[model samples]
Target chain A: MPTGSVQHFLHGSISSNDTLQALLHLLRGLCEDAARGSIPFLDQEISYTIQLATGNSSMSLRARRSLMYEGYPWLLTYYGHTDSADSSRLVAVRTCVQAGTSDELPKFLSCIGFKKDFELVSKGHVFKKGDMRVIISKFYNPVKDPTHPDGYQPLANEYLVEMSAVSPKFCEVLAREMHTFAEQLKPLVYFEKFIPESL
Target chain B: MVVVMLISWESPEGMSPGHANEKLQKKIEILGGKILGKWDVDCEVYSSLNGIVGLSDTQTTQPANLGGATAPQQAIYVLHNSNYSLSTFAILEDNTVLIADSSFDQFMPHMKVFYKKGQRSDAKGNRYELNEFIIKTGVATFGGSQQKILLLEITYLLSDYVHESIGIIRELAKLLLDNSFPGIETPITVREDKKFSPSDLLLQYKALFSHVKKPSTVK
Candidate 1:
């Protein structure tokens, strides 16, 4: 759940210039491929949307051993800001795939952000100010919780505390682990990179 | 009772579990079959890149089964007959896949139901079927996001050492049985998308069937 604030830009220190270049590189290549096949991949731009306070206060707990993150689904967040007090400067990088492939990219992007690359076996946590917060573990699926006290409900609802001030810390850790992660993120900065030669 | 089975699925990060599970649960729905529950655990890594999902023998003296293995934590095991284990199943990314714990397999093997290849059958039909003495270890990362496992669209086979179905499913026959586990009349039928329904579970178990099938993909 994102705060829906522009603070996302200021928090993660994400760069729009670099990410945009990369996305252009990728989109251009995709277009070329589509053209070769006589299939125009219209709507080649990335899309952004926010999961605001929908009043969907649902949550599930992961095993202490298997918990991949602490604060989660309930809490929405914005990533990397252009400046502190980011009034309205945050970006969400998402590429469209055929309906069949839309579900695939989420996992791939997560793998790109985290270093371990392993599906989070452990739902980790970080306690701050005596309040337990979501730990930053990448590739973790928050939906696998079967032991919901609510007794078997939707896999969605990750009962996590929403916090922007500290949540960015998780992103920073992710960025630190992957020097180019911030650049590689599918955000404004990532959109700028030139697609690799392979394209 | 561990189900000692595997579940595989497609991935979409941050996609709400409710959303994905709703989709998959509807897909799992049956004439009467339903999802009882689901759980997520770490994905298991096997030496084989294929989705075989077998663990290497940690010890040599004992069987390849995790409990029997007697080596350091780093040990690997050989695969037993993977047949009779689910035979057919699905994995959706971030979905709550309720895998029976090892405890469930003991009772499940004795569980039997009627099923057919092309037509719906009754309890008295010739297509009577049931999973062998099976157990689940726990929810595992089955057919996971490729980045985590690094191997997808590869070959896989059930282990032979599973011991429950080994005798009945001779190499050739077993392969035939599991591989051909009847694909539900429809793959996208909804089972337990929103909540676990007991009737759905009983109906599915009773309706599901396994057959003589050997997996050629494992090697």
Candidate 2:
């Protein structure tokens, strides 16, 4: 089989809500010609990572399962590392399955025999501009202590801004466009690929 | 990248397990097929999106729901080995395969777990460097229920051509089981007429599990 199209991705973060709003305003003007309406980022999404015991240590063998937007629900994706090891590249083979019912999720996971390791929840919005897709999401970690008023809280103040397209050929062009857009809001928000120490 | 041919072995009407095992073992020994090892394999079904999301109706001019709909027929599954060491994501719609990694969970946010089935089987004879004959008998159950359907799967592994290997496997089965085999004559061709990938093995397991879960006379 055909492996499907290779998706190119660029990651950046805005530290505050004010800067996020400013960047969104700038994008609205830049993508006026090909703007499709906005969609709820992620009303409520829970992500779980399943790992294999004998998978290569250097290379993590994990599959991600997410339930996003109570109305839309199930999305299952498998991620595999590509030949390139460049952290900035972040390329991988992604296989996806869209389930029709909530009942299918557990059955699918059990059939595979993978155990859930860590899970995180997130909420966000998605903006589509022609072939490009942008998501501004805030990830949250569940609180272990029962004393905490809220069951979960934002992992960080920063909001992840990811721009992606399904073609690698569009990487350079998209990068250039995103960079110029970032420059316009430089002082308000910084958008660039910044690798975290843990990842 | 081994090619596989699947043959189902159903015991004659009311034959007991002990009697069936004795006959199968004796036949294999007569054919000089040595037993290699035995283990259990588990399979699970998963989809790309969760819940009852509907796909857009392209025939009409209605606005598309974007990510709000689920396409059940397009769902893919990740089949794991017994120890969960190896996972293969098989896309049934297009027959695509991806060896999943730890980051899979992060990338697939809409993946939902479905049904699970486990099989216990013995490995016999080296068919290829990465291939072998597998005699499997198992039960597929949904959720926490004790109810299960019996399943039998025999796999002949080869890496080169599936059509050719399947013909060889048929002859082997005929020698071992005489007229007892299912005698399915349909050609077992790889999807898209491409060389088999590692994930193709898991596809076989998934197909068998689905069959047991929902048996259809026409399928």
What digit string (tens of lDDT, one per residue) describes model 1 on residues B1-219?
211222222234665433543433332232232333322222121111111111122111211212222321221111111222331111112221223222222221111111001211111101111233222111111231211211011011243222332233333222332332221221112232333222222222221211102211121
Over 4 Å off, model 2:
A32-37, A43-71, A82-103, A142-152, A168-171, A194-199, B1-219
lDDT of 2 by residue, A1-199 (tens): 3333455555778887778777777666656443653555433333444422343221122222344434453444433333244444433222222222222354444333334455666666677766767788887774443554434576787888777556533255655555565566567555555434336
TM-score of chain A of each: 0.18, 0.66
- Tell me the docking grade of candidate 2: incorrect
Q: What is the Å distance of residue B69 in model 2 from its true position?
A: 43
What's the C-alpha lDDT at position A150 in model 2? 33
Per-prediction TM-score to the true structure, in the order listed:
0.17, 0.42
> Interface Cα RMSD for all candidates?
21.0, 15.3
lDDT of 1 by residue, A1-199 (tens): 2222221111122224354345334433432343332221111112222111342321111111212233221111122222323212232211111111112233222221111212232221222211111122112243345685422333232322111222312344322323333344335322221212314
Strongest candidate by DockQ: 2
